[model samples]
Target: MYPFEITTPLTIDAAVQALQNEEAQPLAGGQTLIPTLKARLAMPEVLVSLTGIKELQSIAERDGQLCVGAGVTHANLAKQTAQYPALAALAVDIGDPAVRNRGTIGGSLANNDPAACYPAAALASAATIVTNARAIAADDYFLGMFETALDEGEIITEVRFPIPQAAYYAKFTQPASRFALVGVFVARFADAVRVAVTGASEEGVFRWLDAETALSQAFSAQALDGLTVPTEGMMDDIHGTPDYRAHLIAVLTKRAVIAAG
Candidate 1:
């Protein structure tokens, strides 16, 4: 690993100040950042840790939304399984115990790995990314191929997940890394229904418009029947072929709809 100065900033202002330094990078859980640095993929002059910020570690339900702190860990999610069952269920299905213990919701979304699960939930739920600068919509926040709408030196302060009336997340995990090879999150709200597809999209995590439209109307397993997502747009990798993944999108959508019901 490269030599770097580490700053444990207790407030967002301090952390943002540290990030303003040209060579500094904000450190969340260090689950992804540390490995990226150790592999020599990233070399920074400073590490601005968010661990010391007390406000970034809260989780609560308010105004029909679950406002989760940026520092809330997957383990914390699992521990709160009874309250926010869907989110917690998704959390527990993440990586193994160690990784889950160290991974934070903010860290996961900020990294925005193609196979990551949090982004799917955030997208499906139309959650808001509460940052030091502004609140960004889940639809607008995710860019593409490991990118997001966050500005340089900006910090994700919290995330607001809309409380869905019913929801389910389904994924086909890689046996080793436990990363999603193809994952889908489907939710039904009083106003509308939404479906977000991850792991299977070549463009990155995205809303499955067709499936969402179908589910919004019927909200059933058969609502996804005879539906076809273009294979041209889905990810084709060692895990599965493009056609197979396209099919999985439909299959998983049905499963998630059924689970939600």
Candidate 2:
């Protein structure tokens, strides 16, 4: 890693101010950043660590939503199996124990890897992203692969996920990276059904609207029997083809719907 100054800020205000330096970067759990630094992919002049900021590490239920702090670790989230079982279940499958122990939700969302799991959860659950500047809806937050609506020097403070009547996340992950090659998250509400697909699209994580419409009308795996997603926009990597990923989208959606039930 290149030589850089590491600052541990006690408050969000201080962290933002520290990031005002054009060459400074915010360090969350460092799961992804640290490796990039070692490879010389990123060489920031300074690193502002959010670990010391007390307000950014918490989990609570408020006004019928689960408010998760940006700094909350995956391991911590996995333990809350009673309140949000679907999210907790997904958390346990994210990376190995060591990575889960250090990876933060904010870090994962901000990085916005095309195959990452949390974006699907956030979008499917209709979660709101809370940042230092403003709150952004999940629909508007994710722009594309490795892209988001976050501004420079802005920091995510919390994420608020509305409790759903039923929800499930199913992922077909790459064995080595444990990143989803094709993943689906299904959420059922009283009025609507939300379905989000990740690790397949070229533009990144997106909702499967047709399946949502079908499932909303009749909540069952049979509802999606003939539904198909176009393969033109999906990723075609060494591990899977676009056709295969598209097929998995339908397969996983059905599995998720059945699992949700």
Candidate 3:
């Protein structure tokens, strides 16, 4: 890893100033950034650590919404019962305790690794990604595999989630890493339903439109019967075949529907 100057920014304005300069990166919990640096995938001239900014480390319940600061870590989420139980469940399914302790929501969404859990939660809850400049809806924030709408040097400030009526997350995890091989987050809105799928798509994350439509009509496990998941663009590595993953999507969606119900 290259040696870099580290600057601990005490305010968002200070952080933004550092980030707006060339080859400067904001350091959050360091779970992902540290590894990327060690792997030489990322080499920044300056690191503006956000941890010391107390405003970025808080979680608040306001106006019927749960607004979590971008710096909030998985370990903190796992231990908090005040969060929607479904989101907490999803947090528990992240990496091991050590990873959880260091992984931050902003870092996760900024990285947007295909198998990451935050994208699922953000999509399912229709959360807003608050950036230093503006707030982008989750659907608009995630552009593609490891891509986001955020501009260079723009740092995420917070993520705002409207409290759902009811929601649940179920993931078919890869044993060794505990990353989702296929994870489903099911949410119950007052009038409509939203189902977001992560982990089994070559396009990264997607909405199970059929399952979502089925649940909209009749929210039950049987509602998923006869649904055929398209096998196109799914991963086909040694982990599983495309057809195997397609089949799992249907089955897991049903189980999640039932469990969520």
Candidate with maximal lDDT: 2
Error of 3 at 113 (Å): 0.7
Worst 10 residues of 3 by lDDT: 77-86
lDDT of 2 by residue, 139-223 (tens): 9999999999999889999999998999999999899999999999999988999999999998889999999999999999999
How do the residues 19-125 of candidate 1 rate in per-residue lDDT, one tens digit apiece? Answer: 99999988998998999999989898899999889989988888988999999889997786465577789999999899988889999999899889999999999
Model 3 residue 204 distance off true place after TM-score fit, in angstroms: 1.3
Per-model TM-score versus the true fold: 0.97, 0.98, 0.96
Measured by TM-score, the strongest candidate is 2
Clashes of each: 0, 0, 0
Model 2 CA deviation exceeding 4 Å by range:
none
TM-score computed on alpha carbons, candidate 2: 0.98
Q: Rank by lDDT, descending?
A: 2, 1, 3
Taken over the whole model, the C-alpha lDDT of each candidate is 0.89, 0.94, 0.85
Per-residue CA lDDT of candidate 3, range 1-261, in tens? 788999998999999998888888889989878988999998999999998888888888888788889888998876763658888888877988888888898899998877788898899888999999999998898888889999999999999988788888888898876888888888878887888888888877778888888998988888888998889998887887889888888877877778877
